[model samples]
Target chain A: DARVTQTPRHKVTEMGQEVTMRCQPILGHNTVFWYRQTMMQGLELLAYFRNRAPLDDSGMPKDRFSAEMPDATLATLKIQPSEPRDSAVYFCASGSPRTGLMNTEAFFGQGTRLTVV
Target chain B: EDKVVQSPLSLVVHEGDTVTLNCSYEVTNFRSLLWYKQEKKAPTFLFMLTSSGIEKKSGRLSSILDKKELFSILNITATQTGDSAVYLCAVEGGGGSNYKLTFGKGTLLTVNP
Candidate 1:
């Protein structure tokens, strides 16, 4: 079955280090989303791309966090100078909404667990 | 701001019992409500409800939405230990960024044998 693949299932980094997480969306999906999950905040949307173009990234911290889709197959989220508060599970999801399709369900990857000390 | 709220932040029940999780939302130009199950990792899609009064079911798990009430309910009958997880509720609203989803805190459910 098709699934979204994420690399480096776990990561441990010191504060101020740069961390990069990668995702490979389902082959034919057109929409990809990046989310951060924390115990207190639950799941927060960081960014999303439709057709390989970023549709929104308002939820991300522009100063330190960046999300990009190098191509249809690869989407990346990078945090420069990571802080202790940045420790969380990062998830990537993809969905394909065809015409007349309502509320297309997003398929999520296993996620990358990042721990910043 | 778009907001989603889930009731009974946590619940514990014996196996074979039934449970109902509640989700309420306040959003502008509402689009749809979605349910997800999260274990130790990423949350997986469970159901998406758009129209009110339409019940969606998959085996022992079923859900329904109420547009007028601005809430939804997820029911699991004959619960199993494997069903222990956090149930997340998300709402999609229309407008400038219609594709974005607002999620609730989620209900943590534990099933004991």
Candidate 2:
């Protein structure tokens, strides 16, 4: 089946360490989104890209978090000098918007669970 | 900011029972509302409602939206243990947010046999 792929289903890191999550979106989808989920914050949109170009990343912390789509197929989210508050499940979703609107039918990958101690 | 709120943060029911999950939103320039079911892994697409008062159905699951009230409801009849999952509601559309999705804190459903 054509599904979004994520690497390292689980990751544990020490404080001040770096963590990177990779995602391979389903072929042919033109939009990719990165989200972080936590018990307190629920689901928060960190960043999103359309046609391999970033459209918005206002939700991400510029100092520590960065997201990029190197190509049409691969997207990455990185946290440099990760902190405990960054522990959460990060998800990657992709879809093709219908006409001029944002995609309502989005597909998500099995999230990457990160923990920092 | 566009916002979505789901009711009854969690619910528990027995097999064969009928249940309804609620989702309310406040978004500018509304385009569409979508529902998803998430198990232990990724969330899977369930339904997308664009028009007001139109119902979308598949198997034992169905959903309807209300543009006037800016809300939607998902109904599952004759629930099974396999239906135990988190139901998510997402809305797309807002000023400068046409390419972004705003999600709710899904409702967790637990069905026991």
Q: Best candidate, DockQ-wise?
A: 1
Candidate 2 lDDT by residue in tens digits, B28-65: 78878999999888889999888999999999999999
| Per-residue lDDT value at A89 in model 2 | 95
Residues A89-116, model 1: lDDT tens digits? 9999998874686455788999999999
lDDT of 2 by residue, A1-117 (tens): 999999889999999999999999999989899999997778899999988889889999999999999899899999998999999999999988667755457899999999999
Per-candidate clashes, comma-separated: 0, 0
| B1-113: candidate 1 lDDT, tens digit per residue | 78899989999999999999999999988888999999988889999889999999999999999999999999999999999999999998757545767789999999999
The positional error of residue A97 in candidate 1, measured at the CA in angstroms, is 1.0
- All models: lDDT? 0.92, 0.91
